[model samples]
Target chain A: MQHEREHTLKAFDQDLDRLRALISEMGGLAEHAIGEAMRCLVERDVAGARRIVQDDKKLDALEIETERRVVQLIALRAPMAGDLRDSVAALKISGVVERIGDYAKNIARRVPELQDVGHLEPLSLLPEMARIATHMVHDVLDAFVNRDAEAAVKVAERDQALDDFYDSIFRTLLTFMMEKPNNISHATQLLFVAKNLERVGDHATNIAEMVYYAATGGQMTERLEKAGAL
Target chain B: MQHEREHTLKAFDQDLDRLRALISEMGGLAEHAIGEAMRCLVERDVAGARRIVQDDKKLDALEIETERRVVQLIALRAPMAGDLRDSVAALKISGVVERIGDYAKNIARRVPELQDVGHLEPLSLLPEMARIATHMVHDVLDAFVNRDAEAAVKVAERDQALDDFYDSIFRTLLTFMMEKPNNISHATQLLFVAKNLERVGDHATNIAEMVYYAATGGQMTERLEKAGAL
Candidate 1:
């Protein structure tokens, strides 16, 4: 009986390890999608943008598979407490990562429209913001894999910098649109691209919160709020 | 032994019912929050907007409780297959609904910022778009409660109209900002407001997809895409 129990436990551990690996793989794909989408914008690579849009389907499929594994693990193992939280967190994080991929795809879709418009000053900020957002996605997923609450807390703190970048870009875009009425069309699209990056940052923060909860079984909001106040 | 099994089944049913009730309650609160936020924006009710921001905490608390209940139920019951899907769906839906509440709060927070700027033409459409988005939220939750895949599919279809409204408003705001450079600041804020409403519509669609999946044990993306193509 003890040997049988050990076998089941080993299987459960493998199931969890597999789930984490799936999330890491999905995260890598999402990060690549964001990078490629931004590259499409920077290099004016319409074909590359289209490819990112097409690639989002793979992330979607992975999310479905990850969710299936989560449900199966929960049902088969009946994980309690921290273990259950880990499974649920993986499920939620996969959904968030898929959304980040969608945002990347959305950004990519805007590239073809912007091709005809002349470059504006604020256009330069897009890639920088995308870089920061992608980095957050990377670090937060790593935190999840490591079960590092401190790293997750640090990731949450970094969102403010992204917000600041967005604010500066918003001001610059407004000035550009105000100076040249014709700049309004492309400027607004850039505004959306910036907003999408900002949202990616927010999703990263959400994942951090989930990771914090999974690690400590305690709410992260209070600590985040206190950190914000500081 | 049979009697014990029956008792366990009864408890599981009650637990699921309780989860549904909590979700319904949270959904109602979120709907109220959205309405109040829109009302604040339309009426320039700063106090009311402040109230919506504060009230978002309630939704947050409910989400935590719902998650805890879900973890407990999963651990205790080891629900398999369809039953596990139901629990997971509830879990995912709670997070989505909470986010809808956050978007409402975000809109409300913008009200104070908009107070110093004069109204633009597109500002008039904000409340109308919000109404549609909130209605989608309501109907989607109802679909979940009733296990109505048809209703969920219908809710998903309605998001297109919301997207249309947003596109029209976006163009109008761009025109207003271009016609007078001074209109840029207020117009940009209105643009954000409209985008937030559009996102609420998206969240509603997310819920509809989850509800449809829970009801049919099949993905809704293909159907949604076909509908989009039509």
Candidate 2:
């Protein structure tokens, strides 16, 4: 009986590992979708945008599967302590992954409209913004995979950089519009593009916070607040 | 032992009701915030916007409390079947409410930026869009509270109204900039306001879908396809 009980413990452990692997896998896929979507924006690649939309299905399926597995694990194992933390975290992280996938889809959805609007006067800043936001998404996922607190902290702090880039784009576009009235059409679309990237940055920050929770079983954002950091 | 079991069942049912009430309260607060934020936009009332931001703390606190109670219930009761459905639905609904609050907060944050700028051409459509979206949020919450499937379906179908309004706002803002070069700054801010409303509309639709799920337990949006239906 004792041997059988030990065997079941091994099985539960395997399930936990599987859950982690699936989440990380989904996280990577979500990051790829974000990457290609950003690439679509900078390059004006409609086909790439289409791919992100098409690929979202797999991410969605993975998300639903992860949810089911977590619930089942909770039910079957009645997991407590660290196991419970992990199962709950998977649920929250899956929600975030699903949303990140949606953002990727959103970036693609704008491609068709933005493609019609011709390039804005200051194109470099928008793409540069996308580049940084995309990299932040990548870093947060990597941090999660390696359980790296420092990397997660880095991702969280990088949100301010995205904000700075957004402001720069806004100011540059403002000047461009003042110079040429017709630039308005392209500039508006670029604004949406920048806003989307900012939102993506926000989501990455959210994921980083989650990783902080996972790493320490304690919320790190609170620490940031206590330290008088925004 | 029999009496103790009966007491446990009664306590679990009461807990479920309390969870329902808690979500309804949060939903009510969020729905109010969205409405006030929209009114602030339409009236260009900075004070209203300030109110939304201030009230958001209340919503946030409610969210945290709701989450805590949910985890506690799950840990203590280990509910199954319908009881489990009720608790899980509360968790999902709380998330939807929290996001709605965030959207309201976003609208408020943008208000200060737009207060000085005269309401541009696209600004006209925002009020209508906000009205439609807020109604959707209210209706969805009503559906959840009353278990009214018809109301849920109605909210789902009305999402297109929000989309059409967004497109009108988008085009008008574009034309505003093209026709009058001086309106670029105001035009851009209005653009952000419209997009924020559109996003709030999406969150409204998300809540409506959740109402559908709680009432029907069938995931329609998955197979429904994203037809750019706002």
What would the per-residue lDDT of candidate 1 be over residues A52-105, giving only the tens digit for each residue?
989899999999999888877877788777888899899999999999999999
Alpha-carbon lDDT, every model? 0.89, 0.77
Residues A1-230 of candidate 2: C-alpha lDDT, one tens digit per residue: 99988887898889977877887788788778877776787688999899899999998888779877776677677766666766776777788878878877987887776686665557666666776887887788778767787789889998998888888888888878878776666676667777777888998898888788767777777778887886
Query: Which has the greatest TM-score?
Result: 1
Among residues 3 or more apart in sequence or in different chains, the pairs in candidate 2 whose N, CA or C atoms overlap within 3 Å are none
TM-score of 2: 0.89
Every model's DockQ, to 2 decimals? 0.73, 0.52
Q: List all candidate RMSDs to the true structure.
A: 2.1, 3.2
- Residues B51-134, candidate 1: write the lDDT tens digits: 999999999999989988887887778886677778889999999999999998998998887776655567778888888999
Show pairs that collide, candidate 1.
none
Winning model by lDDT: 1
Q: Model 1 in CAPRI terms: which quality?
A: medium
